[model samples]
Target: MNQPDHEFPDESRTIRPHAGESIEDTRNWPGLALVAVGLVLLALTLTAAGYGFAGWAVIAGALCGVCLLGGIGIVVAEHRRVKAR
Candidate 1:
């Protein structure tokens, strides 16, 4: 008997993980920690302004911006690094 025609090839056979791909998706813990802190700082910034601590609100906002940008930079860098190989 002939085998039945399939709709598509098995996808897993054609796909492979990048060499740099982490099973745990955990690179440096510090980067994840910074992202977490940035989120908290952003929340705190809004709270600080609401509580009338204008100066602290400004400082926290700036720090939050820095952390957000840095985390984004790290992600871009990792993507580039993996794709290059």
Candidate 2:
């Protein structure tokens, strides 16, 4: 009778999580918060700059733009961190 191979692969044994592993470490909460704040500020700035429905739309667009830029900045920073790791 032929016997089957019983050896497990090395990769399978190395998949355990580390004791200090944390989801928070990889998250950029502070950067995201800053982006939110910047968006609010941009909205306020646009509102202060005008009035009426058109003014509100302008303000919202400006705020969205600022938020987009801030998000891009945060994403770039995160990318750098990932590359470093």
Candidate 3:
């Protein structure tokens, strides 16, 4: 009746994926995309500001803020979703 330790898995330490949910479903693609856009806009804003394009810098800076906020929101929402589940 003696079995080796390797014969059984330790359920307590194991993580199981939910049914009907693929690994890809857990990724926040949109959130990551928004963050990327925000970073790009930030670079543009700095460049414009350095060249004395006040209007362009202001516009890009505003857009960068919006994109960063939106991305953070999406990421938080996704985190809550997974936690709730």
Whole-model lDDT values for every prediction: 0.73, 0.62, 0.80
Give the per-residue lDDT of model 3 (tens digit) for 1-85.
9975762334345555344332255467788789999999999999999999999999999999999999879877886676566
Off by over 4 Å in 1: 1-25
Off by over 4 Å in 2: 1-23, 34-52
Query: Deviation in angstroms for 71 in model 1?
Result: 1.0
Residue pairs clashing, model 1: none
Give residue 45's error in model 1 in angstroms: 0.3
lDDT of 2 by residue, 20-70 (tens): 332244566655776777777677666765665676667667777777687
Clashing pairs in 3: none
lDDT of 1 by residue, 1-85 (tens): 9996664433334454455453235653456677778999999999999999999999999999999878767765665564464
Error (Å) of candidate 2 at residue 46 is 15
Q: Lowest summed lDDT over 10 consecutive residues: which window, candidate 1?
A: 7-16
lDDT at 11, model 1: 31
Error of 1 at 42 (Å): 0.3
Give me the candidate number with maximum lDDT.
3
Question: Which pairs of residues have clashing backbones in candidate 2?
Answer: none
